[model samples]
Target: MSKKERKLSAAEQRRKEKFLEKCSTMETEGYRMENLSFSVLQINLLSVFIALPVNFLFMFSYFLFNDFSLRSVYLPYAPLLFLLIFLLLIVVHEAIHGITWGYFAPDGRKSIEYGVIWQALTPYCTCSSPLTKKQYFWGALMPTIILGFLPGIIAIITGWEPLFFVSQFMILAGAGDFLIVARLLLHRPKNAQVIYLDHPYECGLVAFLKNID
Candidate 1:
């Protein structure tokens, strides 16, 4: 026999009710709802795919532009050290997201929430309230620029192999953010104010458009 459906606990039920209520309010306010879900594995795989080519291009450019071999940038560090450093940077990466998002969040830093997805074992930083399209865009892209592209560029210029590698990894790490940005651009309304709210339990967000009527 099929197992009986399990009922939601009071808290879970209330959370679901709250989300539904929010959805209703959004619809009533002329905002459409779009849900995009990505699993942890999918995000990681995408990151890998994106990072490989990017890394290759950057390495190739560095080699072509400069007269030094790739070995010039390689740091003589133990593998364990590199792993530990990468792990630390991962924490910093999430912190960067929270800090940047908090800057533009309506409630300031308090509106930014940090937590881990138990099933995926992935950490996330999300804004509790919605933010303008510009603000959201900056918040979404800050970590990628500051921790990823910028550092990578600097490393390439200064011939710092270790930092360049770490930065490239960060770029890959930010694949999810790039995905969100793409979605926002695709569905964004012209001449309307846009705001987005992070999905509580998913790897995506909800966009709300306020038509300039």
Candidate 2:
């Protein structure tokens, strides 16, 4: 009721309005509202069905050429390597997303954030600020298709079993690709479904969601 309190409230409203406007503009340029209806299971199954056998054959051919054992090479520091590989794969996956989108975004700024969805009990990376759907899709899959698979090929040529590790990482990235493809196929709204971030306070929505629950 006081004048100072009213002034503060007005300032907060203005800030929120500005942020919302920015979000709206970005959405208009990059995404269209859609009804996404695919379940995580469906996407996972599809990805497995397609990627597994292909990856297996690729791995087999790789080892046939170079004679590297994933199990053997992974022994000395399996635990440490798993941790390292997992973290590195995540960075590589997200970096590819950023790079691809950054190449196309109007401002060429791609922001990324990591967090846990306690409800789902998983951590995910959010990629933001793709200028359009094409940029979004390309950025989303670049990691899996490029960094993930190419290294495995290189590893096969060099007889490095670690390439299997990288290939597996690519499969993990493929899982993300599956989800994105399914979501898009099912028609998910951009504001509600797209995962990339484009601003300084990109995690603001996540914080907002957490506070509400």
lDDT of 2 by residue, 136-189 (tens): 567666777776677777777777776666676677557646565444445334
When summed lDDT is taken over every stretch of 10 residues in candidate 2, the lowest stretch is 204-213
Off by over 4 Å in 2: 1-32, 37-46, 71-74, 110-114, 127-130, 182-213
Clashes of 1: 0
TM-score for candidate 2, residues paired by index: 0.59
Candidate 1 lDDT by residue in tens digits, 101-200: 8988878898776766555567788677777767877887888889888898888788777677778778877878787776666775678766677665
| Pairs in clash, predicted candidate 2 | 34-187, 35-187, 36-187, 36-188, 127-196, 127-197, 128-196, 128-197
Best by lDDT: 1
Off by over 4 Å in 1: 1-18, 66-77, 190-193, 210-213
Q: Cα lDDT for residue 10, model 1?
A: 54
Native-referenced Cα lDDT, model 2: 0.53
